[model samples]
Target chain A: MKLVISIAGDNLQSPFDARFGRAAAFCLVDSDTGAWTAHANPALEAAGGAGVQAAQFVAGLGARAVVSGAYGPKAYASLSAAGIAMHLAPGNAPRTAADVLAQFQAGALNQAQAATQDGRH
Target chain B: MRIVVASGKGGTGKTTVATSLALVGGESVRCLDCDVEAPNAALFLHPVLDRRQEVGIPLPRVDTALCTHCGKCAEVCQYHAIAVLGQTTLVFPELCHGCGSCTRLCPEAAITEHLHVTGVLEGGLTADGLEFARGLLQVGEPMAVPVIRELKRWPPLRRPALEIWDAPPGASCPVVETLRGADFALLVTEPTPFGLHDLKQVVGIARALEIPAGVVVNRDGIGDQGVDAYCADQGLPILLRIPMERRIAEGLARGRSLLETAPDYRPAFQALLAAIQDRVNTEYAP
Candidate 1:
């Protein structure tokens, strides 16, 4: 199963975007088989129609699960509806990526939830 | 006179220096904290807001009830902010750059553009006669330009007012938006290697923007001599050197504005103000 993960604060996942300027993205390897690709959550710069294109870009990448720090309500819903799994990474970077993929493979990952869990945003 | 106090790197004491300058400049000045995200200047100045304005960005609102999924809106969007897949259309608010290309390109007129509030611009007066202003980006919103733009458009400070802009770090949109059209940019920096690295980044940005820039070395005793040397080599004047004093850190830790404690530092800020005024006058002399 393909996966999508949000690396920075679970805002959104962008595998192809080089946004945020200095964030890093890498493919997580499990059993020496690369199982996931993660990238930084650069601030999004699209408005209106461009927004849809961004969502489409992520959806088409065959991401089944997204392990991110956080996700907005709209994005959570759209990705969830598309059957993309969402995992909340407690921390960020290479460690977060490893932990998330491990949790998913163990079938212990919870269903993706909206950002309002923190009563913020 | 508009004075933008900025640093290319975050946590380099930009807010600290800006707040001190405002306090020293007396009440005839306005201080605008353009660092929308993580604005800490208010923690020191702590002004009561007297005015507030909603800052928003235009996003396309697609009428789902309209027939057809032509995907024309997505095709014209240069930033890829919108997309239509099969019978469904998806919108990523954070990715939207607020350009109206989609609504304009829609042949069926199904897409109507609307404004979405991303942040708030606030203005008020501190008890010490200093005017305070800042923009608060709604958590999760990515765009800082609209808020910064609105903050700048706020009524020009009653003239002759020394405007201190506490700008966001880095050379990105937020930083550019804050520095745009400023008369002078005061680059706040530390004496560390990281500070020197980011300072060069900001200096390049300032040169690109064609703005006259200077440096204010915070924590002068620590770090190395690279900052001073760089300024001399680049012909960028060193505007102020804030010696790394324990009392300064202590006062900040206790939430007391630096000027409130070390009143002697007031003269330094005043002198720096005078020097800046003189330099600007000389440079812009007719």
Candidate 2:
């Protein structure tokens, strides 16, 4: 299973990006091998519908679950359709991607059943 | 020629100018208040709005019984208006652009379309004999272009010698729709910083659409010459200037035209019209 985490930098130590659709980058981790890679979010500057596009990109990457600080209604809907569980990163924010991944692996993070906030109109 | 009276900033007197022009031009003019979201030129023009036509957009509807849930419709929608989850498909009409791509691309032939009323187009005749029309967008309707389009076409005849379009304030999609096929953009502005900033934005839109524009400086004595200097630098003529006077505003508050407030400006407006005709003749002649 692969896990995708919205992030701010290319490394595991980078802060988790709270914004799902317009996040600067996404950190994808191989659950079995503990190997990971970062991809710059192509939907960061999208004119509109960034949330749905990002959700599609994450699903295309074969991510079984996603970790992020927040999820928008559209992103939540799309990810749910793709059968990917969404996990919120623990702490106020700026929590490292590795910390979020560890908490998820440790079963500390909770799965989100709905969107945390509204998105752009 | 169709002349659009636009103000990049709000409260710069687009309606005042447009309504006055319509009143002055009388039988030869067709006045279209295209600011559908807040159609207020009627307040001053007092057109007897008797004709009403509801405007709507085509929205997609899925026939679940025929749908195979292949997710092809979801994949084809650029706005994510449709989503397929498991064996169920969801359609979000608010996000749909009504391109009919989902209906045409669906291999299962499950998608259909239905009309959704978004606004109404109203037509009437002013007491002064000019044809008047306006669009009223339904509250909370995100789209205004359809209403404006319907209003523009509701007149039944484009044979009027001139069409004065009272456009909405701003350089957004609604403004673009209003300016689309206009022969000239009679831009109204106040000589203020905010007015100057927004004027530049609208100017860019007009230039992009290849429409000629002129400036009308309202509330002239209240602010600096930023707008004047900008216009001078850009070679745009300042056609008319209404002084910042309380009496003129008081007359407007009472729903009176500029000609009603002070008849002295009647000749000025006429001269302004003549100048526009001369410019259009020499520069815009086909």
Candidate 3:
């Protein structure tokens, strides 16, 4: 399974970004092979509907799951419809994407069951 | 001539000036309270509303039986108002702007337009023989332009008479929409730094839209002369300066027009109207 994690920088050592749509970059990791690739988030500077756009971007990349601080209603709806799982990262603290992926592998993170009201438009 | 009474900041006496002008202008004046988010000109004008019409926007309703689940509507929606999930498609009405693009672009012809009520348009006559109209937006509605458009398109609005529009605050889309096609714009501002900052934005919008505009400094004596200096530098006419008075505030609180309570202030409003007409005539001369 491939997992996409929102990040502030374009490297595995970059801190995990809490925001899903406005994140500067996304790190796509292959869970079985432990290989990862970084892509710039095109929705970072969108005027509106950034969350849904980001969800579409990851879904197009065939990501099975997404890790972020929260998911808006539109983003949640898109991801849920595409059968992609959502997991909540730890707070806004400076944790690397690699650390988050490891936490997910160790079952230390919580899976999001529904969309959060944190940043719904 | 159409004169829009607008302000960059709220609570700057826009309705006070607008209603006062409508009252002083009398039988030939028609007032439209275009601030649909919070219509308050009627509170002061006290117009007897005898007509009410529902204002609606065309929202898309998907016919699930005919939908191909191709997600074309979701792809075309800029607001993310629609999400096509497998065999199910969901519509978020509040997020929809009723642009009808999705309905038109649907390849399977499964989308149909449905009327969604956004607000109500009301028309009536004030006790003093002035024509009055206002748009009241429904609670929690994000868009007010549809209601304002309906109010502007009302038959009485196009009649041969003096038209005064009390626009909403801020230089956003709604303000631009209200100021469009007006012969003159009366920018109301208080004499303060924040007031001056926002006034500059509204003025910029008016100048960009190529509408001739003047300034009305409400609460004139309370703050410094920054607004005055800015207007002077811009060469914009200072139409009127209403002095800051506790009596004016008290009267407004009781929903009374300054023209009715003070009576002496009626001339100022009338002069303001005349100045607007004169400027429009001179600047727009053939």
DockQ winner among the candidates? 3
i-RMSD of all predictions: 4.6, 2.3, 2.3
In model 3, state the lDDT of residue B109. Answer: 99
Candidate 2 residues A1-121, lDDT tens each?
A: 7999999899788998888998999999987687999999978886667787788789878899999878888888888888899998754745788888888888888888789887756
lDDT score for residue B280 of model 2: 77
lDDT of each: 0.72, 0.86, 0.88
Candidate 2 ranges beyond 4 A from true positions: A30-35, B155-158, B284-286
What docking grade does candidate 2 earn?
A: acceptable
In the range B97-170, model 3's lDDT, one tens digit per residue, is: 88988999999999999889999999898788789999999997878998999888888833647999999999
DockQ of 3: 0.42
Candidates 1 and 2: which is better by DockQ? 2
Q: Output the TM-score of candidate 2.
A: 0.88
TM-score of chain B of each: 0.93, 0.95, 0.97
**lDDT (tens digit, per residue) of candidate 2 on B1-286:** 7899999999999998998888777587899999999888998888898888888778888998999988898788888778776566777666776788998999988988898789998888878877888899999778888888778767544479988999999899999999999988999999999999999999999999998889999999899989989999999999999998898899988988777888888888888888887887877567
Best by TM-score: 3
